[model samples]
Each structure stands twice: as structure tokens, then as C-alpha cells.
Target: MSPSGKPPRAVDIVRRGLLTRPWRSAVEAVRPPWSPQESQFTQACTRCGRCVEACPGGILQRGDGGYPAADFRHGGCTFCYACAGACPEGLFLPRDGRAWDIVATVTAGCLALQAVECRRCQESCADGAIIFRPVAGGLWQPQLNRSACSGCGGCVAGCPVSAIKMEHSHGRSLAGM
Candidate 1:
């Protein structure tokens, strides 16, 4: 652990992974859409587990020891941004408006696929946005009720295989030009 009290071992493990994971590296390398709300927010975040500990939803976790990774599996982020408020480094940049600007996507490994009848993700959703529907093969597929989805990204973290993805929801549109 260094002066910030974050464990060196944990930091090293995350750093190594980020250095090797091209996809993750690419995302972090992308210039933030906007400057952090606080001038020191970007630099002061030590990637320590403090903010994560403060998270009541367990949605916030260490993302390469750099940013807050929110998983919206159990529930969506209430836009509370509590982790941001608790961050000592002020690294968590608040959008001030449009909290759903960050969107989380649940990938292939949905809980239903793991088990024929498991509705763990749906049940975990406090917003009741995820619905299970019978598909072509009588298999239940989890559908996102967009109106109910708040883009909390909590599902991403709870995933055993990290099948969830967090994406910027407000950017480019697919409408025909």
C-alpha cells in the first residue's frame, strides 16, 4: 500500500490487466468527453477501494484502479453518483445533468442462459425493467424495458463473465442522414 492506502498488490494486478487488455486500454485512452467537474478529480482518484466501500449498491468498483465501474445487474444507478461524491480524488466526473448518459448493456451471458429458469437478473432489478420472454425455441430471453432502464450499469459488475458493457448513450445516432 502507498500513501493513499490502496494496496500495491491490487493496483499492480489491475494495472497489468489494463496494460494488456487492448479493449480496456482503448476505452481508458479515449479522452474523457468532458473535463472532470473538479480540476483534481481526474488526478486524485487513487483507484483505492474507498469509494467502492462507500457504495451501498456495490455498483461502484475499481476499473483499472482509475475510474468508477458501475454494474447495473442487481439494480440501476439511481444517478446518485454517491461513489463520485465519496471519491477523495474527485475523479468521478459528474455530468450535472442526464445521469443516464452512461448506458450499460448486458451481454450474451445473461443469467437465464446459465440456468433454464433463473431470473436472477430480473429479480435483482429494483426498477422492474428487465422482463423474461419466451423466444423461438421456448427459451426465455431477458429484454430490457428501456423506459424502466436507468443505465446504472450494475448488471455489468454482477455478471460472472463480464458480459455487460457500459456505453455512452447520448452520442451519435443511427438515423438516416
Candidate 2:
């Protein structure tokens, strides 16, 4: 109820609920590139800062429990194998294997969906994963190519509306490759 004793509108109530709830579905702990399954990686990792220092992308940081984690806000991963090479423990898999199965996903807060023209996400995507398709009498709609996306998080930080996120692929386990 408002200070004036009026009930809040249904839209306002729904909006508040949505805003309060965690919006980042990919809130799971993000490990460094080429990391083994979470359980094994945690057990094998020695909490050393070598990998963090070796990462040229500046995305790797000390995460919870003093383990290395990737924070893509600074930049996208280049898959340079620096972190893996620097790690003293055998916590990472072979560099030839897929780095990770996570992929970029766009949420409803996109400006284009709200009738605003914006293409920052698509432009920042280096892999050409994000494509815009024109809509008749309306703004173009962005579509994500999950297959093409390297899950490097290139488009996340550049999004003007903060609509991009990295989510685990469907039918894939977050732990295993």
C-alpha cells in the first residue's frame, strides 16, 4: 500500500518482483578456461595466482573460496592458453578440447524489444554470433546463433541495457565437458 493508502498497481507489483529476483541466470561460479569439471577442478586447484596473472584478457580473478574465476566484464576471452600453461596443478583439460559449453543469451530488457534502436551487442560480437533481422514497420530484432557463439562473453559488457548473459547450454551438464 502507498503512503496515500492506495494499493499498488498490478504492473508495478510484478515489476518489483522481477527486479528483486536475481536476473542473472548464469550466476553459477565461472572458472578459468580449460578448467576440468567443477568438483575435480576445486579439489585439484591450489589457490595459486599464476593463472590469474597469466591471463592477458584480465578476465580471470580470485573468486569465492580463493579459487580462480572468470569475470567477463573487463573483456572477452582470447583462448590464448596462458592460464592453463601457468597453472601448476592439473586442473585443466587439454587445450584442444572445447573451452566451455556456456553460450550468450539475450534477455527481455533489450532496447529493440522496447521499440528503441540499439545494436551494441551485435557489433561487439567478434564471432558473428548475434544477427539482426529487420521487422516490417518496426525495429530490427536480434537473433543469437548459439552454434557460432564461442561463449567468450564478448557481447555482455557492451550491451547498453545490460540484457546479455552467459547461460549453460541445454542438454549439457555444467560440470562436465
Candidate 3:
């Protein structure tokens, strides 16, 4: 309630929530085309973990706060888009001809850096999008060969640390892919 007797705005409340942390604010600011549904659905989601279990591709996971977040870089998302169908909250986005629409970024847990033997991230790639190469010390690093990648997110699902990320393609490729 305010002196004017009007109710506080919901956007104001969201602003406060985001202002609490710069990192979170930045993350919230970088919303992808699919993010509106993600934000709206996450708010509505009860955090039941049911959708996580239902995901055959395993691209979905509970965030540190125990909310569903799609980690796409560590591995890749099959983009079967089933998560959208199973989510009671309607959190997942409709892929209808849009599976390749989303672009992803690699920030952490690249199996090539963690363990050379584990090319699971590369091998599991459904679209053959990830290109693995041997580098210094004979280590393999995962790279998204955009030409080959269909943006399926299989690598994102297979990553153990949930390091990979799906973002709007920046029209560039990682150096070591």
C-alpha cells in the first residue's frame, strides 16, 4: 500500500528481486526468445522435479535453487521439446520447427577440459554439431561447428556439471572446437 492508496506494481517487485544481485540481474537481463516462457513457467512451477525425470534427453536439471534450467553446452539438447509437453507449468518452449532456432554457448564443464577420455559430450551430440580436436597435451576440447550442429542439446544433457549453456548464437565459434 502506498500513500496514494494504490497497489505496488509486480514489475517493481521483480526489479527488487533482480537488484539484489548483479550476477543474477545480468543473467535475468540476457533473456533468450524462449526466456519469457521460462521465467513465467518457472514462477508457476512447483519445483516438483517430475519434468526432470520425464526428460528422456536429460537436458533439464534443477538449478542450485532447485528450479528447472536447461543446460545445453555441456552436452546438447535433443530438442525433442518434450519438456514443453510434460511441464505442468508450461515452462518448456514449443520447438515446432524451432529446434535449430536457439543458439547455445559453452562456458563450463567442457568434458574436453575436464577429462580427455570422456568425449561423452562430443559423442552424444545428436546432430554431430560438436567438433572435438586434440590439442596441447593431447587433450580434446568440445567445439560447436555451427555448420554441423543442429542445436539438439544432447551434449548439454550429458554433461555432469551442467556447464554447457544454450544462448542465441553470437555468430562466432569457440577457438578450440
Candidate 4:
């Protein structure tokens, strides 16, 4: 009912419906680049979709609780800072700071590690972080150059065996994949 104590119109009903859409509890999701710590980000963000919509790489998506999340299945980040510019809440940190400690790691499931000739991940990487090094067994093993890795996740989806994963560099897992 309105303040006038009369019936609401159709537009009012639709607006209420949209505002009342079911909201899920926050979870461990991959946040966009230059985002603050998860705890701080959730607290500071206002659930506006501007950051996700401003991403030129198309890697950002509307995630849990209508928050912005990074999805790298399609492409790598160009580090264009469009998301940060679009944010009205100023939740993201400065671009000069490190974009988290995340980095790409090649798991044992990699086809190249199994004595199979595969280089899809290497081909997809724009940073040249994945290096094929010769091992004692005369097999070319894919070695990760942590310093060179940008953690853009470009190689993850291109791996034929799904062997690539992004994780914190200090052995702590990122919780949600």
C-alpha cells in the first residue's frame, strides 16, 4: 500500500518484485581484479552491476549476492582498469598494488606431464609463464614461472586435461574454484 493508503500500480508491483529477488549468502567466489580482500569487498560493495558491465575483457560476471566476480573461462584480463573506474563505491584498490597473490599452477593431470605431447595451455598463455623444460627423463615438463605469471587464468580453460588452476602462491588454497 502507498502512503496514500491506496492500491499499488503495476509498475510498483514489478519494482517491488525486482527489489525482492532472492539473494544468496556470500560465498568464496573469484572477485574482479584490484578488488579488496573478500571480507572487505563484501562489506564495501553495494551490489551494483556497474563494475561487471564495465569490464572490457568480458571476464566479470554477476556472482553470488549480485556481487561482481571474475570468470576467466572465455579470455584473460587486459588489466585495463575499467572495472575500477566504473565502481561508484570505490571498493577496488589502486591499480599500482599487486592484484592479489594468485598465480597459475600446472597440476599432475597435465597431458605433457604424462608423456603426452600437448601444448594447448602454453598456446593460450599470453604472459609466457608456462615453460616447457627438459627433465631427467628426457620429457619436456611444463614449468610455471611464478614471477611472470599474472594469474589471468587464460591457460586454465585451454588445457585439454583441465590441469591448470589459480591459487595463492604460499600454498594456501583459494577455497572456491
Candidate achieving the largest lDDT: 2
The 10 consecutive residues of candidate 1 with the worst lDDT sum are 29-38
Per-residue lDDT of candidate 3, residues 1-177 (tens digit): 978999976677767767776645335222111434445755777778776676675556676467665554433454555655666666545555444345445565665577646666666676777767778887877777765666556665666665565554654332111
| Residue 96, model 3, lDDT | 51
Question: Residue by residue across 91-131, what tens digits does model 4's lDDT show?
Answer: 88999977767888888898998999998888988999988
Model 3 ranges off by over 4 Å: 1-20, 28-96, 114-116, 171-177
Per-residue alpha-carbon lDDT of candidate 2 for residues 61-97, written as tens digits (9 for 90 to 100): 8886788888777778999989999988766889887
Off by over 4 Å in 4: 1-27, 175-177
The lDDT per prediction is 0.54, 0.81, 0.56, 0.80
C-alpha RMSD values across all candidates? 10.6, 6.3, 11.7, 11.8
Worst 10 residues of 4 by lDDT: 19-28
| Superposed Cα deviation of residue 118, candidate 4 (Å) | 1.0
What does the lDDT read for residue 171 in candidate 4? Answer: 60
1 or 4, greater by TM-score: 4
